[model samples]
Target chain A: MTQTFEIAVIGATGTVGETLVQILEELAFPVGTLYLLAGSNSAGASVPFRGKNVRVREVDEFDFSKAQLAFFAAGPAVTLGFAPRATAAGCAVIDLSGALPAEQAPPVVPEANAHVLEGLQKPFQVSSPSPSATNLAVVLAPLRGLVDIQRVSVTANLAVSALGREAVSELARQTAELLNVRPLEPAFFDRQMAFNLLAQVGKPDAKGHTDLEKRLIHELRAVLDTPALKVSATCVQAPVFFGDSLTVSLQLAAPVDLAAVNRALEAAPGIELVEEGDYPTAVGDAVGQDVVYAGRIRAGVDDPAELNMWLTSDNVRKGAALNAVQLAQLLIKRLV
Target chain B: MTQTFEIAVIGATGTVGETLVQILEELAFPVGTLYLLAGSNSAGASVPFRGKNVRVREVDEFDFSKAQLAFFAAGPAVTLGFAPRATAAGCAVIDLSGALPAEQAPPVVPEANAHVLEGLQKPFQVSSPSPSATNLAVVLAPLRGLVDIQRVSVTANLAVSALGREAVSELARQTAELLNVRPLEPAFFDRQMAFNLLAQVGKPDAKGHTDLEKRLIHELRAVLDTPALKVSATCVQAPVFFGDSLTVSLQLAAPVDLAAVNRALEAAPGIELVEEGDYPTAVGDAVGQDVVYAGRIRAGVDDPAELNMWLTSDNVRKGAALNAVQLAQLLIKRLV
Candidate 1:
């Protein structure tokens, strides 16, 4: 028998949240009913789900008691406040934000670590991976099968506007002004977002790592189940509007061939291998796509232990919304 | 009595060649006489130099008989054929291509390795440093005084249109056409040079490194005089029309602070530091400028040895024409 699930989409108006609604419609997921939840400011607005307008209710007032699943795209504060309540209501929470209390939550990439969510008796919480995690996970999938990862270093040229819708608008407006067209005043970002790249992403942690970078390293380890792995990241914001690109260098525990690496990626789901001479997938190419586009894979000429590749993904979709929806779909498949 | 130099500029109507004429005029070089040489197709054209319309002479017909210095900005083939003839004519040959026979040529970056060219009893043959070397030499000047180098990994997102005027025009036309503005057929590059980033630059070496990447690696070693140092580069073409941006990750020999890096770069000539907040220098900012703009400098939280920085420069000026002219100025001051 076909199963239908009731779902709550928290932060329904956000970039990721909006994408979640769109993907649900596109995939034709068996949705019996949908709830749209957001903060006080966004409450009362409506987003379309299954061809019907669903009004967004404040998170505090939302009834999670009847929902079988909840997708949290809101910030940590909202996720922290509402996720436990929803879980208490017996709803599985798929969180896109990294703010979930780690002890109770498990970070997941559906393809890489979907099994981690299969046996949870209690209402389980799964997080949508960060842009970096979304990038590294797909590339790592091929490598993990071949050799153990000794160390991984990634430098990200993250697009500044990937922060949110406001950031994206701010960049578009500022770019117009910078080129003597029209002024887009700075409000969403702390500084000028036009024609410039920023090095800072998430708030700085006590140890100086950006919160996003730290989370990516942590999430990578957690999802891969390699506790002893060494991971370091230097994330910088680029002027692009949508996609995030990373130059990843990995040191493996054993030697691996480039052809084998390509084979692994070819077999992986939701990954499109971009070959040399193909355009390096940019923000525009990834803006509405769910798949991770990867290219420029090269084994180091001097060292077999070293491998390099470029990973590009739509920060809003694969990095957040689609992953959340995918997790929800997996939960439904595993549960009654 | 002042010694006068008769100079001939091969490829005189091209971007670098035009800039060379302008710079020579601006620097007031002692030009006893000047000859402009171009391909047979451009033989009848005239380019303005020092307020005079200098008729372009066929490169094949040009006699270097009276010239004391010859600047070859033509392609490798022309340099391979004509540079030797100029040298045989008792002229000091400054080749931009570096494809000149190794036995007769020594690579030179005026600021970093000009001393190598001093007091040559035989007419010296020097080739311009690669764009990457020209950039690294200027930025490394400050770093050398601050920290010892261990290794560097660089990914060059080079704009191939930086190759020449024809490529630039082709790219602009193609971009416009791609956006449905007008038809701009491909001419200079092998494919449509619009809205795309190509990965190959120059010819690929047997091991698959691009000619420019190979030259940069070798030229950097020669200019820095660091034979044992390790370097790896991935060069890719971007849709940009002018500047080149390098995302550099360095493993320093000693621990260094980000502040020290900022201060060092600030004090360094030909480099503008854009470190604070989200202010990253863009290709537009560096276009038509001489300075290499360094920004978004950050330290790796997990690994102190790893530091990330972004560098952008006008490939035509600082990367090519301006640098060659600077070498000429240095030669005039120290040798002539």
Candidate 2:
């Protein structure tokens, strides 16, 4: 007889959470019972799964012992609040938030660092890195030995959907108002978001680095297992709604071989390398895709040691929900 | 007596050309006869100068000798076709198009290298660098002495207006169609550009570097007079109507002092350095502005030798038209 485990999805009504539930259904991950949980404000909302509406219950009142595994798809505070309880009940926790310390819950991108999972013990805890880090890791993992990467500089054009459904709706409203020639009153965003790009994604610290930017640097280094790698990151909030577009430039220790790099990228899993002379964009190519689309690959104009690329992927899907689900798939094997 | 020279603006009906004419009036540049010339399609159009509308004549028929100076704001082909005639007619040439070789028409950002203008002979020809190059030259000129720069990486978020009026109108139309739930049929742009960012601004060469990207690298090196400087440039076509946003990361030879860097930027001309907490956006802060708006300045997360910054400016006004006009302001002295 086949056996299946019951699972709980925290923050199930949120954008990434709902997508997580949908991905679970799409991937058919041997689910027996699904519990959708959210905070008090969203507890009554219903998320659809397998053509049925699953009403969300409050995370505060739920008992963690009922489920063998739980996915925390909410903010850092929510993960910090309920993660311990779930782990204490012997539930394996997969955190989508960058809340737990790297020592406690090592960030894992299955395509890059799947072997890290073998190191964890019972009542396992693993973290899915931030959207930018996850997408970059998937693309960069293949080039680990192909080039001696010395420094990496990335400019991430993030979508509004990364913020939440409210930010997504705000973009639509702002665009409509501006198109109709109505006076724009910015709400969800501090400034006009339609037809514009916001340089800073979040509040910067004293050193003028936003949490998102620092997160990309830290998580990328952790997943790549290169602690001393020099990374420069800029997370800009684009007018886009769904996917994240990244412009990446890498400084290598020696002149690179373009033919070998292309061959490696083509053979790598979890990435779709578009043919040369054609590039991918977030809305058209990456919005509903499962793999990260990479194109415009070339060495620098004059410096052969420099390499540049354009990458796009679904931030909520491949970057977050799908990554968490992939980790869960690996965990299910050892759970029983 | 105040002496004014006759000036002709080729491609006067273009976005940059129109703005150049307007700046000539606003900055009170000495203009004797302002002859507006464009291609046959735009020849019959009229553009406002001072209080009256000036009729644009056909460039093919306009006599180059009729003006002492000519501003070639059209495409490189048009500049290549008519600039030699203007020079032969003893007309001082200011080419906004990157058609002429750097040796013949040296790229100049007045704030960075106005000294290049002093070496010119009669019927002088000077090229106004690309918007991205011009903006970067202005910001980097002040930092030349402050840091020992080794390499530069840039991701330029360009507006559709850089492609002129048709591209701008397409963005508006694509946006409205998407907002109204109507089927989108992309016209000027090859893809859905409403809420999407096109990774490539123009067709890339065999090496995957577009002409615009190469122009930026070449022009920046010339303007800063750093011929061997290493630069990695990625120019993305954003959905914005105006203003270009650039994310820059510089690798320095040694550790940087943040306080000293801030002081240099604060004292720099042609730039507005926003405070630490508040940042600038293209639509909210840079559109229709003369100076580049810079914010989110910091070092790398762990590397002190790396400096990153965000910059936004009116691509047509401050980047092209105003810079050209500023050059002409200095040229009027030598013209007479």
Candidate 3:
């Protein structure tokens, strides 16, 4: 007999939160009771779960102690404040935001860093990797053991949904406006994003790197556990809606055979390898899937020791929601 | 007083050719007589030159001997057949196609390699640098003397206009359709380009590298005269209508100071340097401009020897039409 757990999903009406509810049912997670909670504006809304409408409760009024496991897909401010309260109330929390848990729980990509959760149980606060870092970690995890990775250079093409549902709606409206030759005003992004590529994703830090780029590097180092890993990232906001794409170049410590690398990527978990003659596209291949779809893999022509490839995944599904769901499943298994 | 020359513009009805005609007038080129020629299909159509409409003549029916200078902005096959015929008929040819000249004339980016055109006269044949190579050559030419560039890695984000007018129209149509929830069918590009980035540009060679990538490597070496300069290029088609963007990384033989690199880029001809805080964007800064706008220049975190930057330019203006006009001006100067 399976033991069912009471679950709470914060920000349940948002993009990732709604997906998380659907993914829970799709994955057939045994749930005794499901509670959907959102901000006051979205509190009265109804969201579907398991073919039934679940009424969203106001997060401010909900008690954290009611649920055994709580998934926080809320924004940073909400996660920073309420996550602590939820954890103190004896509920396990899986943060999808790239925030450090109050308990300083290790950031985990279950397929990449499952060893970290070997003995963890309920009442522990942990993090599911950010959609950006999760995809990169999944691809780089297998290669770390195959050969020492000296350095990595990533050019991530992020979609609008990485911002939020407002960004998606803005893109749609702005695109329509532009098509009808109406003037555009940027609201969500600081620049025009419709039918255009914006090199700046998040705001820049003191060193001139955007927050998104810096986060990718910091998280990859901790998740990969290569304390001195050299990472260079350039994040661009592509004119896409659902998927995140990356052009990654890896400098290996030793020269690895191309055929061997190909074999390893093909067999790697949480990734699907599309070799030459079939490149992986964002909308066509990655938007609905949980796997990291990768292609255009090659040994760098300038240096055989370097490997380059294109990686894409559903930033909403694999990057955030599915990654969180997968982590929750891993945590649930160790609950007993 | 400016001396005038008889000019023939092949492919007069096409996108770049139209831009070429407008730019020639905008820059006040000395044109005694302008002959507009296209395929048989566009024979009776009229194109505007100097506020006057000139009837488009069938390319086959026009006599190449009548014009003193011929600008072949036509497709490669048309250029291959007609350019040689025009050259044989005692007319000088300026090719924008970037193919090796049929008469083995040197390819030139006038701003960077104008010295190559020193004593060349009328009836001589030459090729203009492709828009890709022109901007890169202009930026790299000045730096070659200051620092020895050992290797270059470029990720070019190209616009639909790079493909042609049909592509621009398709992007416009597809974007409008997508906004209205209408179905889409790919025409010019094999993938959906409404709000997506395509990893593939040109057809792949036997080694899985696309022809566009190989051409960038070859032309950069030839134009910069860095014979052994190693280049790894990945060309991605972005979903914009008019501008081109590139993320470039350069490995130098010796470490160079950041201040010196900034000075060289700023002083370089036909390029405007944007500093760290303010970066140049493709759509915002590059369209309708002759300058290659570049910014985000920085050193690699792992190795300061590696320099990276963002480059953008008007693909039609600087990338094609203006580069050709500049070359023709150089050729005309030599003739006088």
Candidate 4:
């Protein structure tokens, strides 16, 4: 008989949380009972699942110990306050937000570091990964092990949905307004994010790098577990909705050819290669896809030591929901 | 007093031609008489100029020698056949297309190469510079002299306006169709050109690089006279209607810091630096502007020998119209 576990989805009304619930049902994650919890804003909202409408309950009133596992997709503030509570109630937590404290609980991209998660014994354990970093790290992990990466330069064309649902709707609304010859009113972003690319994504920290850029640096290092890897990234807020596209240039310690890199990517799991005519695009090919679609593979013009590629992934799926679900599944397999 | 010249604008009904005429009026180029010539399709169309409508005349019937200067804004096929005829008829030609014969007539960015136009002696001479290459070359010329640029990798996010007027309207129409939940019809471009990015702009050659990429390589070499400079580019057809944005990463022979890069950019002509808390964007800053806005200056993480920058320019203005007008002005001064 297949044993089932009780599960709870915090912030059930958000996009990532909804996607997490869907993936659980789609993957048939052996759920005995499901509780969808939210704050007053989305408390009464009804989410359909398994041929039934489950109304959202207040997260404050819901008993955390009732569910053996909890997936937190709330914002940083909510996750900060409630994640510890859920853990104290003896629930293993898989957090989609990167706002976890530096408490050494282990930030994980399951594909990259699944070895560490095989024999965990701690009850109520919690871990998180940066959404943007999760996608990049999964793609880089296999390559990092194969090639001695000397330096890496990344230009990430991130979609508005990377921000949240509001930003995606804002793009559609602003684009409509502009198309009708009406003035665009900016909200949720500093400048017009529709039909325009913004160089800055988040607020700047002390080093003149945007907070998003700095986060990518820290999180990529943590996910790849390479403390000294040299990486630089330019985060651009592109005028798309659901996916993040990255142009990655890697400088290796030794020279390599197209065949070797192709071998590396093909061997790596959770990545789909698009090699033929018309490379993958965010709007056209990457939406609703679990695997990162990588294409436009070319060697550096200057030397054989470097390689360049284009990567597109649905940031909502692989970047957040699927990674979280995979980590949750790993947590289950670790139970002794 | 300013000396007047008789000028004809080929392809007078197109976007580049309309912009060129407006710029001539805005910059007050000394014109004795203007002839707006188009093909059979736009023969009777009237373009507004100097507060009145100027009817488009048939290019086949018009005498090329009647005007001393001919600006070939038409497609390459027309220019290929007519440019030599205009030159043979003693009309000086400023061909914007890069398909000119391989003989070394100065391919100029006036700011970087005004010295080459000082003593021209060919009576029916023609010169050309690719629009995309002109923007990139103007920015790189200053840095090429300062730093030993080992290699450059560029990601150009080009707008539909670069393709011409029909592509612009296609974006509008496709966006409306997509917003209304209707299927998109790809007419001018191979794929849907609304809210999507295409990796290939021109036809791909044998080496998998697009024709546009080949042009950038050839023209940048001709503009900077750096035959050995290593350069590679990926041209993306972005959803924006105007202004092209570029992300350029340069690997130098020696280490440099933020202050040095800032100093070089500050000293460069025809450049505007956007610093701290704000950066230049294609939409908010570049449209209708004559200056190339360069900002988001960052150095490499692991090595100080590398630098990255964000560049945006009005492709119609500095890329085509203003550069052509400036060259015409240069030719006028060279007449003595």
Best by DockQ: 2
RMSD of 4: 2.9
| Candidates sorted by TM-score, best first | 2, 3, 4, 1
For the record, the alpha-carbon RMSD of candidate 3 to the native fold, in angstroms, is 2.7
Worst 10 residues of 2 chain A by lDDT: A1-10
The lDDT, on a scale of 0 to 1, for candidate 1 is: 0.74
Which pairs of residues collide in model 2? none
Candidate 4 per-residue lDDT, tens place, B1-336, comes to 778989899888888889999988998988778999988899999999899999999988889889888898888787887778787787888887765753535677887777777655565454557667878877887776678887777778888888889888888898899888898888888776676667668766544567677778777877787878777677878888888888888888898667876888888888888986678888999989998898877776556777878889988888888888888888876553
* Native contacts retained, all candidates in order: 0.12, 0.96, 0.39, 0.39
DockQ of each: 0.23, 0.93, 0.50, 0.47
> For candidate 2, lDDT tens digit of each residue in A38-118?
999999999999999999999999999999999999999999999999999999999998999999899999999999999
lDDT of 3 by residue, A1-336 (tens): 989999999989988999999999999998889999988999999999888899999988989999989999988777887888888899998887767642376788877887877756557777877777889999888876687887777788899998889999888878888888899988877777887777677766655677677678877887888768877778888889889888887877777677777788888999999968779889888998989998888776657777778889999899989888888888888775
Off by over 4 Å in 4: A60-63, A88-90, A101-105, A119-128, A142-148, A252-256, A263-267, A301-305, B58-63, B101-103, B119-128, B144-147, B301-303
lDDT of 1 by residue, B1-336 (tens): 777678899989888888888878877878888899989987888888789899989989878877878889888899988988887887778888869644467677776777777744457678787677788777876787777787667777676545887776676566546445465567777664443335457655444457787677777777777766667676766555667777777777767777888888898788888745433444446777878888657665566666767788887778888888777666655445
Worst 10 residues of 4 chain B by lDDT: B119-128
Most accurate candidate by lDDT = 2
Model 2, position A19: C-alpha lDDT score: 93
Per-residue lDDT of model 1, residues A90-193, tens digit only: 89888878898556788888778888887566677778878778768866865676877776777676765467787766765665564554555677766654
Candidate number achieving the greatest TM-score relative to the actual structure: 2
Going through the candidates in order, state the TM-score of chain A alone for each one.
Answer: 0.94, 0.99, 0.96, 0.95
lDDT of 4 by residue, A89-175 (tens): 888887766667534356788778777565455664556676668778888888875678876677787888878789889999988
Model 1 - which docking category? acceptable
List per-model TM-scores for chain B. 0.92, 0.99, 0.96, 0.95
Instruction: Give the Å error, residue B78, model 4.
Output: 3.2
